[model samples]
Target: MLLALAVVPAVVQEAVLVGIGFHGARGLAPQVTAVWPYDSYHDLRWLLIYHNSWWHFLFGLVALAVFRGLLSAGLTALAWPGQVPRPSFAWLLRRNLEVAALALVVISPWAALSVAFSAVALSLYLFASLIPMLVLAPFLQRAGVARTWWRGLPTIELLGWSVLNFAVLTIAGAVISSTSGWWGVLVAALAGVANGLLWRQTVTAAVLPARIRLARVPVAPVAIILTMAAAVAAQPILNLVTGPPQEWMPLVVTERLPDRVPHAVIVIAGHDSHWSGRQPADPRVERFSYQGLDRQGRPLPYRHTATHRSLDSSSVLLRAQVEALHRRTGRPVALIGSSEGAMVARTYLEKGPKPSPVEAVLLFSPLIQPGRAYYPPPGYSGWGVATGWELRGLFWLVGLGRADRSRPDEPFVRSVLVNAPFYRNRTLCPVAGVRMIAFLPTVSAAEAPPGEYSRIPVFQLPAFHGGLIGRRAAEERVVDFLAGGHVDQPRREYALLQRLGAAWQAPPLALVLNPVWAAEREADPAFTGRICEPR
Candidate 1:
């Protein structure tokens, strides 16, 4: 019943939001209806990455406060004794708004910071899962949520939900996850429902009568996985009717790279990793340099810096190398880049002059933002009706020489964050003709999933930043994708991510099955034109 209650409102919420054309902001919806563990943190994350417009985002927040807030409070009131006086609407609204504001201002950033650091990623996920049960449940219970499966059992804390979650995570989470295309959303939601079932003793005693009771404890796992499988299998056929996800890309990873795969490719190393090291044995693959260094790995007068000029410099070298390789092999060059080098590859595709050279790009955890480890998008979204002023503001920022010009990665922090079209264009529209896939570190995204907000088909790896650079599996998957062969995800590592409280599911189901995919695209733009355009 608790789980069903959560799902029921989610359908209504998603429908109303989409019916009004705000699917981009749907990330703000509970991962699985109302059983969401972290409310404030997720709400803010969706607003920045998946929002349609500031108005839409704000409207969603208000709706969350009014509808969810009022409903939750009403339920709490009803759960208490009949003699108790119900809280007034004004009081409920004020309390909900306060909690929402507090989350947006204080708690959200702190949670984001905890996830950004790799060492703390798993701990953060645990804390996130616990927030709903340990913190919110108790608070509401104390505030008169009289009935819960909360009886104090004998050492059940040591033997119950923790063990159950751990077992489910180890045996099923990731493997079952792939079965359903909607793994990210549905499993996340169901797991959310399961999170509250930790009170085995109390739940068994009370819930056996009221509803699904503890059956959901075992049943949810089966439902989530089977549902995901059906969705994934059905998606390709459905796409025939709806058309391909033009802007969205779907990809997977592996464990090893075949040594003798016959493909023409170029390898771009991350910051400071140049041709000085032992080169790859395969003659089909060549490594390029952007630090103005000689082919023998000697440094030149110019050094790489965090400016647009460095991007132009490396992009020019990339063009020359791709053209050379293409001519030699009589085939298009496939780009494989790691870290900062991946950003260089991204810049070339986005801003490098027409007629893209590379046919396929495999980027290992590219830096999407310039300055900060994580930077949320500014509000407003688009230029409303007048798109021309978008270009004018960009020109004014560029012509006025306003970039900080740091000396680390490719672009200055201000360039991307301050609307200079740093990595992605400030206007944030999709460009044509380049097949690109990004492999992201699961640890980095364990808590705050930056890739979820990206338009690129981001493949989650069990490895950390720079972890997938030479992995044979990733290399093999890249080869398979380039050759149009079968591509699938790694088997075991995904469970590690799931154990840490994230749904390490693949992306295709949402792209195909979810009707609000276009809104998701809008929500996940690089940057928007809200600054000078009055969106």
Candidate 2:
């Protein structure tokens, strides 16, 4: 009921806003739910939250507060009990509000990024994972719930329960979005209650915590842990037996635009997208963002193929394309690579023939320098990296040592493993006129050394797993950069929502994780926040 009090009001407000945004589209629930948290944030951010109309903007501000601030305070209030003669309601409300506010200092950065991802799943996880520090900031609370970390139960929680909770609630939100009218209201309420129960059980460990306490010998914990372990280990084994669906999207070039443009963009795609990839045969400016850039550099088409004999071979193909494009156009070329494709782009730039004709490069989610993935507990970052390591061990343990990464690895892990690293770091040689930048997600790793990205702007977006390309904000900035517009990355975040605990354009993860990003390492002279287009 308390959780409902927190979740339902905002949800209702969101429903109205969705209705308004839908602009009389039929099936409010279906329209709202069709794209989900991705489109949810996009519409809210662009159309509503930052709408041109004054009243719409004001309403968006209030709605944002109701959605985030209220939820935080409510979660804090709920988790705040268990202390002696629990404080009075008035005092409880005030004090918990204070705690939620302080936690906001921490949450804002992450929240901004979550909004950036456009996926509520990550946002929910961000809140669930960290709010436990605030005792019931909604979803899983580690300090209170997972008391069996010493006995290796935390591994299960981190690898299993937390993921489950994040995924389920995300789906639940979608379910709620899918209902409307009076019947839909009831359905939404019921869905809200169901989610509340799950959140309560997860946040408080209602079911397992009690059993854990009663069974002093960890019998319950062990049994539960083993079951979860088997479940986790089972899926991959099944996949190994029954390989994943692989439907590769081939590059189709039918001469839609002039091929001899001034700047040709070449994109090197990451691992199997289920393998979805599309290359604009004859784009006006050679890439998505460079459509208007008749003079600026253009990136190569994003390329993905399972047929590459090796990473080196992939880079060779990139060089061949780069040379071929430059020869035809007699113009400079830019390289845009994502995931393993980013590594392939990096290799060509670093080791290709000297006096490199490639004048600009944009690496999306590259793995040029992945930090140590497997460290001890409180392992803050590197879940993506950790998964790769875990998979290697799991496959080896299951007697599949030779399992090819082509099928075995997730995109994140494969990126890290692809450019494993040299005995030592390579010296960077950044060109004076050339514009080189990397659009990074939440994870650390500069993708290049201090000097390599010394001049160009390195964007820290809220995207991951090849999601940067999908974000509107990222696309806008990328278009500007590709078009040769001077990029001015933001140094500090827009502070309008500091009091309300809102996060804007800055990377929320950098506040604690990446000091390099937080410091805005080596931004150019033309740096400007994308919060608004200030003349």
Candidate 3:
């Protein structure tokens, strides 16, 4: 019954979205022809607001309330067995409407901010609003509970669970809405079922019943499996529909010289949803091959659309491609990797069965230990610190699988960081022969211990993470390095370190008291640096 009720809203929403050409066929089908919708947050938001009516939004809110009420009531009945009476549809509907009304009221202020400010502001407001709701919603529900329930309520656990649940639902909804045809409908139905089960379990835990004991359903596994399956299925199809993957293929912008030069440059793009490699217009190197396939073997069209699977597979593929290029051209390769691509290059060189044809490997803002690399240090104080952390947390939650279908690189990157040791252990092939050079930003350089690996030479660049890829001086250094020439003047920027020392630390309550501080950090020179380097 709970599943049936939950599915109604999902089916209705899908139908309505499709009918209005907002979700299926005419809408997502056309947009996702060349790219997946995982990273298209702004576009998706605009579509929802522009294509959908106020009635549609209202209906969705009401449906959400009804579903929550029914699920909670059903779970309560099951848990108490003989003690609690089964709620009638009308009673459940009434309770749900009341709960929904309260929720809408709480969220309406944040929602109204959408009119005055950007969606980003509204999103931050919405996230801020959810913290209180997570803590209070269980208590607010009319479901019979002991007076002492509030005293024993697990606030932290409930908040974490709510965050996880929200992540799952949001990802599921995004996938469903972005997909077209019967496939979208089918995925939406599965998501609805999963949502119902998750809600039932969450309610069961929140409102602990005194009498009857019911066996716990494996909600996490079920949701994970459902989400993973949907993500994997959605990714490749979206890629195929968006257009030919050739547009994303590695382009040989400059023709190779008739005489085979000993060294060739192979550039691997960082964690982006598009073909992001920028070939140097240098005439010294004959050929340049940009990495075409993202970690998931799909064409990268923009940021956040590609899916990421095992780095091992991608590494193997990279090795094969590099080897083929080397064999055909009869030239030794010099690999230049940025961000996640740098990690892939390292993996390939360290783990591949065949020895790398490359003589030199250059890593720009390479993420070797993701946990350490991406983490904000204790003394760091920036405007967007809290927001950045929250966004990172959300990405981590959404990307918890073999493939990050919705937000491709984030989870995979996190997995790589967490499993760095595992990959390191698999480094049976020696990299002593490869002259690896690492160009790290000041902030990242602080985290990375220099000379950890004797063979790889780590240089501290006076730039931000994104800046390393775009700076002309950095690019020239890369070109020189590929040509087996050394960087003349390597300098460290201690400005970030000095600023970290001088800036006042944000209080723990700052997240609630002044959430704007998170955004402020982004603009702060102390956190991001004073240098205006392009990415």
Supply candidate 2's per-residue lDDT for 167.
47
Residue 299, candidate 1: Cα error in Å is 7.6
Off by more than 4 A, model 3: 1-261, 276-304, 372-393, 396-411, 414-418, 422-430, 446-455, 488-490, 494-535
Q: In candidate 1, where is summed lDDT lowest over 10 consecutive residues?
A: 504-513
Task: Encode model 1's per-residue lDDT on 449-488: one tens digit a residue.
Answer: 2222245455666775567655666755777767755444
TM-score computed on alpha carbons, candidate 2: 0.40
Evaluated with TM-score, which candidate comes out highest?
1
Give the per-residue lDDT digits (tens) of candidate 3, residues 127-200. 33333433343333322222233233333444454455445544554454334455656655665566556555
State each model's CA lDDT, in order: 0.41, 0.39, 0.41
Residue 526 error for model 2, in Å? Answer: 31
**Model 2 residue 199 lDDT score:** 43
For model 3, state the Cα shift of residue 306 in Å.
3.7
In model 2, which range of ten residues has the least summed lDDT? 497-506
lDDT of candidate 2? 0.39
